[model samples]
Target: MCYQLVERFSACRCLYFQHAVDPCEAYRQRGHSVQEKVVLVGYTCSRHSMRWSGNKARDSTLSDSGYSSIKG
Candidate 1:
């Protein structure tokens, strides 16, 4: 029902532009649907988490506590 063009630049972030464009009711006319096409606007880390900075801190070795550290 609408055409959405997503735009974003971030090291770690997932955002959806709320501005929805009017879509042609017929897929043949428009060529794509929101459900069929996905627009991802962010970055994902190893744990499925967004990166907070452009340069992510290197993860250290993990211990039995499920944490990464240089000295564990």
Candidate 2:
């Protein structure tokens, strides 16, 4: 039997929101504005779920030999 499946992934960039000031007294001593744009970084990871047969007994009866093999 051949099994087929599809997976989905999505990502979006966030717009600039706010600025912050450094209170360490180092940036202030340099006489430069410490305000900076907030940047967002993201990623996606996936786990697999088998599509078993509709019949519970049939699903259970299927051999486990190739069940764990993954195809990207």
Candidate 3:
């Protein structure tokens, strides 16, 4: 039996990282079966995560300044 770990970003479902394959005697054999373990990270990747937080901060600031009437 072989196992491969896949890590993904929770928000955008993007491939965040991958671990090395844990190979066994049956690895690469004709009838080999690979077990995949997927892990969803708690947060989004750095790129998108920062953008989301920044947007929240900006929105809050706008609301606090009595500018909520402004529409996109």
Candidate 4:
């Protein structure tokens, strides 16, 4: 059996909202803001549903003779 599983990734949740800092000089310099959105700086996953990024070999149940032996 092929132990190969596709890696799944999640979107950023913290960037769901937009805000403007009052003390930010750059914002004031523009006279008006371009209404810029927050660029996602990191990644996240819903660890609440399924266990994520755990030890593969140790937690895996697949047989040792599987194709995973040929680690490319």
TM-score of each: 0.27, 0.21, 0.56, 0.22
Question: Ten-residue segment with the worst summed lDDT in candidate 3?
Answer: 58-67
Off by over 4 Å in 2: 1-10, 31-72
Clashes of 4: 0
26-69 per-residue lDDT for model 1 (tens digits): 64554565542334444443443433556775543222223222
lDDT (CA) for every model shown? 0.43, 0.32, 0.65, 0.34
- Candidate achieving higher TM-score, 1 or 2: 1
Residue 1 Cα positional deviation in candidate 2, in Å, after optimal superposition: 60
RMSD of each: 13.0, 17.7, 13.6, 16.1
1-72, model 3: which lDDT tens digit per residue?
899988776666778778999999879789888898987764555555443464473222111222222277
Candidates ranked by TM-score, best first? 3, 1, 4, 2
Best by TM-score: 3
Quality of model 1 by C-alpha lDDT: 0.43
Which parts of model 4 are misplaced by more than 4 Å? 1-10, 15-36, 45-72
Local error of candidate 2 at residue 57 (angstroms):
48
Report the number of the highest-lDDT candidate: 3
